[model samples]
Target: MICIDSISFSFECSHTVLEQISCQIEPGHCLAILGNNGVGKSTLLKCIARIYRPQQGRITINGAELNSLSNRQLAQLLAYVPQHSNAPHMMVFDAVLLGRRPYIQWDSTSRDRQIVSALLEQFQLTSYSARYLNALSGGERQKVFLARAMAQQPQFLLLDEPTNNLDPRNQHEILRYLQELARQQQIGIAVVLHDLNLAIRYCDRFVLMKDAAIYRQGGPEIITPQTIKDVYGISAEIIEHQGARLIVPQMDHITKAADDAKTTANHH
Candidate 1:
């Protein structure tokens, strides 16, 4: 389990990015860090990943303090995928094999090779194993990055806008896979997502942020239309369809109603 306790951060002495933030990433569950852009959603993830250290408070993995762990030890416990990744001129297989670096003593063993190969198959990148990462499309490259993180066998995973490059179909597929991965492996996952529907559907918990502080954090029940309007500064409506709840922005709903009225008037 990863515990974030009353952490605060700032790039400069002034202009705090996050203030008094606290949350928990529990094993076997996926936590979605959600808010409007520039509200410190990404900054919070960076703090947890240790890419940016919080100036105050503490974070711990199980019983070990985050700052106490060495780089190699931390890598063995947590894996993070950023919002944007550069596609380097490296083979797909080699890129993923790099995730095993924390464990390799002098040379990689057959076990490391097996883990990389299995991840390639799991992520459906086995055929692209020989291809260069720079040669693949954006969506494909994103998958390779995710597979690399999974290869680390970390107890916790952190991802930022992981579906940014994927089409609608791939978006759902990847999120669903992550949900399952967390449950099956008992790995705690914290993902930053913009789509509320996707977050409500796949994530086990939600942390809604406003102005760098969490406005609310709980299960799917907390994602009401009122909360959406409060966080996003737009009116929305939550409706159920096919045994699932969906969020529709108020403007879209109004436009659709107007269109229907126009069609009826034309028929009359």
Candidate 2:
């Protein structure tokens, strides 16, 4: 498990991004970090990935302090996929094989090659294994990156907007895969997602962020209509369909405002 204890981070310019945030990423579950843009969702993930160290507080992964761990040691336990990745001219197989660096002493071994091959097949990118990353579409490249991260076989995985480039079908597929992977491998997974319904449907855990801090953290029950309205400032309804909770946001707010303006003009 990854325990974040009162971690707060800010830029050197005195602009605070995350404040006293605390959460946990438990094994065998997929935790969704949900919030509006600029509310420190990505920043929080970066904090966990060690890309940005919090100015205050501490983070411990599987009973080891994050600061005490070496870079290779940390990489063996946690893998992070960012919202965007640069498309290099490297072949897909070679790119994913790079993830096995933590385990390789001097040269790549057969086990590393096998892991890369299996990941390519698992993500349905075997045909594209020889293709360069820069030649693939955004969605394809995203899957390749995910496959590479999984090749690391880390105990914990952190992803920022993993579905950013995916279409609807691909979005569902990827999230489903992640959920199952967490269950089967007992690996902790924390994903920063903007799609509320997708988070509700695919994730078993939730962390709702507001004002650069965690507003609520719990099971699916914490994601209520009122909470949605409060955090997102949008009116929405939660409905149960076939034993699944769904969020239906009211899309007529703009039209209602326009009608109210017309009524005021007529009275004037």
Candidate 3:
């Protein structure tokens, strides 16, 4: 399990990007972090991955503090997939092999090769193992990166906007793979998602951030129209479709009406 307490961070004296954020992510569960642009969803993911140090908070994996872990130790515990994937011009197999660095010595071991081969097959990248990273399409590269992370064999996976560059089908494919990983391997996953529909469909729970803090968090049932309007400043309608909650954004007609009402009240 990963536990965060009173985590906060700010850059260059600006307002805090994350404010006293705390959450518990348990094994075998998938969490989706949802927010508008610039709401610090990615920043929160970085803190969990130990990429950015929180000025005031503690992050612990299992029972050990994250700050105490060495780079190699951390790499073995957590696998991070950022929004953008840029790999060297090497073959896909070599790229995925980088995930084994934490386990292998200076040279690749036979076990490492076996792990990579297995992951390539699992991600359906065996056919493209010899292709260079630059030659693959965006979705293919994303899968390669995921395979690289899976090769690390980390207990937890952190993804930031992982579906940003993929088509709809690939998006579903990647998320489905993540869900399968959580069930099959019992790994904990935290992913930042912009698509509310997909988050509702795939995520087990959600953490909604606004104004540099966690505004509300729960399952999809708690994501009401008022919640969306309050957090996102946009009107929306929520409905249930085959047991899943669907959020549909509406135009700002009520906003204009409210403004007109305020003007009339002031004139009177």
Q: Write the per-residue lDDT of candidate 3 for residues 1-268, one digit (tens) a residue.
A: 9998989998767889999999878789889998889999888988888878989989999999999999999999999998876678899999999999999887999999999999999888999999999999888898889899998999999998888878998899889888888878899999999888888888887888999999988777667788877777778888889986788877576678789899999999
Candidate 2 colliding pairs, count: 0
lDDT of each: 0.93, 0.93, 0.88
Stronger candidate by lDDT (2 vs 3): 2
Assess candidate 1 and give its TM-score to the true structure: 0.92
lDDT of 1 by residue, 37-91 (tens): 8999889988888999999999999989999999999999999999988888899
C-alpha displacement of 132 in model 3, angstroms? 1.4
Per-residue error for 57 in candidate 3, Å, reads 1.0
In order, how many clashes per candidate?
0, 0, 0
For every candidate in turn, the CA RMSD to the true structure comes to 5.4, 2.7, 4.1
Ranking by TM-score: 2, 1, 3
Residue 229 Cα positional deviation in candidate 3, in Å, after optimal superposition: 1.6
**What's model 3's overall lDDT?**
0.88
Q: TM-score each candidate.
A: 0.92, 0.95, 0.90
lDDT: the better of candidates 1 and 3 = 1
Using TM-score as the measure, name the better of candidate 1 and candidate 3. 1
